[model samples]
Target: MSETPHEYPGQLIEQVRTAAAARTPLRITGGNTKAFCDEPTRGEALSTTGWAGIVSHEPSELVVTVRAGTPLAELETVLAGQGQCLPFEPPHFASGGTVGGMVAAGLAGPARASVGTVRDYVLGARFINGRGELLTFGGQVMKNVAGYDVSRALAGSRGQLGVITEVSLKVLPFAPAEATLVFELGQHDALEQLHRWGGQPLPINASCWVKDDTQASAPNLLFLRLRGAVAAVEAAGERMLREAGGTRMDNAQAGPDWALCRDQRLPFFNAPSADLCLWRLSVPQTAPVLNLPWAQLIEWHGAQRWLWAPASAAREIRAAASAVNGHATLFRAGADGAPDLARFDAPSPAIATITQRLRAEFDPSQIFGQPA
Candidate 1:
C-alpha cells in the first residue's frame, strides 16, 4: 500500500477507488490521537487531517456541521463561543484530536451517565465506502428517521466501514451553574449512597470514587458534580451534605479536576511503570466491590471501573467482571500487547453474524482492517 498523492475530498475518493480496484487495504488516520484504542492495523495510511474545517453552524438551532478532520478542540471552542457544548466530553488523550477520531472512538466523559453518550449526540454523517462511493446518512435535525439510522452505527465503527468525511452533531447549552462536592466514605457505603441519590430528584451529574491502595484503612473519596440552575445546585449540595459530611470544592478548582479525570492525567490512571497493564470493566452500578487482586478506581457511580495489573492477571480480572454480569477490556496492554488476551470480549454468535453481514454490505472488498 502506498500513500496517495491526492489531497482533496474528491481526490480521496479516487485514492479509495484505486485501492478498491487493486483490492489493497487502506488504514484511515486522522489526528492520530487514538492509535492505542484498537489492535494495530496494516495498509496504506489515508490521512483525513488534510480535509479539515467547520462546514456549517447554527447556534440558535443548536447544531454544528464540520469536516471529520476538524480538530475537536477547535469545534469545542466554536461551540463555547455560542454558549453551547458537546456534553459527551470526549477525551483527546493527546493534542491534534480530531472530530473524526472523537466520533470513531465513541467515548463519553463523566457527564455521560447523566447527559448522554457520543452516539446520542451524533445527528448525521457522510462517508466514502469501500466501493469508492460516497453516502450520506441521517440529517442535521434531531428527528430524521426515514430509513435505517446508519449514522449512529458509524459513530463507533472506528473507520472500519468507510472513511468519514463530514459530521453533524447536536450541541447543548452550557449549564448555567455547577458545583463539586466531596464525601469521605468506604467503597460499600459510597456505592449505596450513589444508588440512593440516583433514585432521587437531586441534580447529580457525575460521581467518582477513589480509594488509597497504599493505605487500605484510609477512607475513600467520593466526588460528585451538581449542575443546572444555581438554586437547584445549591439545594442539591445542601441535601448531599446532610446525607453525609462533605466539603464543597471551589468552583475554580472543579473545572480542572474534572478535566484531569476526563483525560486520565491523574496518577490513578498511570501504571507506575511501563510493565503494568490497564484494565477497564463496565458493570452494573449496584454491583458489589469486585473481589480482585488489583487496585481499582470507581467512576460513573460504579458503572465503570479501572485497574492496573500484570498482563498475567487477565483471566482472573475478566472472570471477576463476568461474575457480576459485566465485561472487561485490556484498555492498555503491556509491552507485548497481551498476545494471548482478547482486547475486547467476544460478542454472541447471533451478534457476530449480524455484524459480519453489515460489514460485507458496506465493504465487500474488505479494504479496511477487520474488527478489533
Candidate 2:
C-alpha cells in the first residue's frame, strides 16, 4: 500500500523551461542532506521536496515506484512493514535525506561490496530534461531492457543531465537471520582474512576495519557481518570464530554499530585536526595496504578506503590510488575548507568526450549545474 502520489512534474517542467530559456543554471535540491559531498554550484534553487510520495509498491513483485522528493526514511519504513528492504543500504546522512538525493549521490552503505550499488537497483526513471521535456526511461521490472542503461546512468549524474521526478527501484526481502563478528587484527591481516573468506562459501554481507582510538586497550578491530538463512548465518559465525579468532556480538549492540558505520557516525570519521580533509579511495579489493601515512578506515572488503589528510597530500594520495588502478575523491573538505581542490578524479579523455556530448544533448543551454 502507498500514500497518495504527489505529482508535480508539470511545475518542475515549467521551472526548467523558464531557466533554459533565460540561460540560467538551476541547482537541483532534495532535502539537501548531501550538499557538502560535491563542489558548490551557483544557480537558482529548484527544489523537489514538493513532488513526493510513493506511487506504487508491490512487495511480491519486489519493486517500488516512488516520487523523487519522498523522504528516504519514509520509504525504508514502508519497506520494513512489508518485510523488504533496499539491500544496497543507501546512507541517509541526515534526517531529511530524500530518494532523489540518494539516487543522485549513488552512494551505498556497508552491504555494497556483497550486494551491489545504487545504480544496480534503479529499474526506471522519469525526469525533466533541460528543455523542460518530461522523459521516461526503463521500467518497473528487470526484464524491461529498453532504455535501462540510461536510467542506471542517471543514478550518479548529480542533476547534470536532468531533474529526476520519479523512480522505480528493485527491492529484496529481509534476510532470515544475521550476525556480527569482531576480530583483533591489523590492517594487513584483516585485508588478508577478508580476501581469504571471500573465496569461501560464507555469508559475509559487510565488513569494516578501523582503529578504535576511543578504546586504547584494543585499537585495531575488524567487524564482519553475516546475513542469510538462520542455519547459514549460524554456521558461518561459528566457523569464523574458530578459524579467524573473534567474538560474536549481540545483535542489539552490533546493529547500531553497523548503522553508524553505514552513516559515517563512527569516531574514525571525525577529523582530529581542522586542516585534515576526508578522502575516499576506491581501489581493487586485492590492492595492498597504501604506503601513505594517515589515519584510515577500510570498508567494502578493502575496496573502499577512507583517510584523513591535508589538501596538500591530495597528489600523493591520488597517485597511490592510481598506482593500484583506482581513483580517489575529496569526499569532504577540511573545516576551513579547500575550495580550489578538485572533488572528483578527472575522467579519461574518451570518457570526458562522451560526457560532454551527453551534457550537450540533454542540457544544450547548460541550465543544470555541473556534473558530479
Q: Choose the strongest candidate by lDDT.
A: 2
What lDDT score is found at residue 327 in candidate 2? 99
lDDT per residue as tens, model 2, 208-294: 999855566856989999999999999999999999889999999999999999898988888888999999999999999999998
Per-candidate TM-score against the hidden true structure? 0.95, 0.97
lDDT of all the models against the reference? 0.86, 0.92
Off by over 4 Å in 2: 1-7, 214-216
Any residue pairs clashing in model 2, and if so which? none
**lDDT (10s digit) by residue, model 1, range 1-372:** 112234588988999999999998899999888878676777899988878888889999999988888889989998998899998889878899999989888888888889889899888999998998989998999778643268998887888889999899999998899999999988889999999999889888888898767665867899999989999999999988987999999979889989988888877887766888888899998899898877788888889999999888888988899999998988888877776777888877997898788789888899887533
Error of 1 at 316 (Å): 1.2
In model 1, which residue pairs have backbone atoms overlapping below 3 Å?
none
- In model 1, what lDDT does residue 44 have? 90
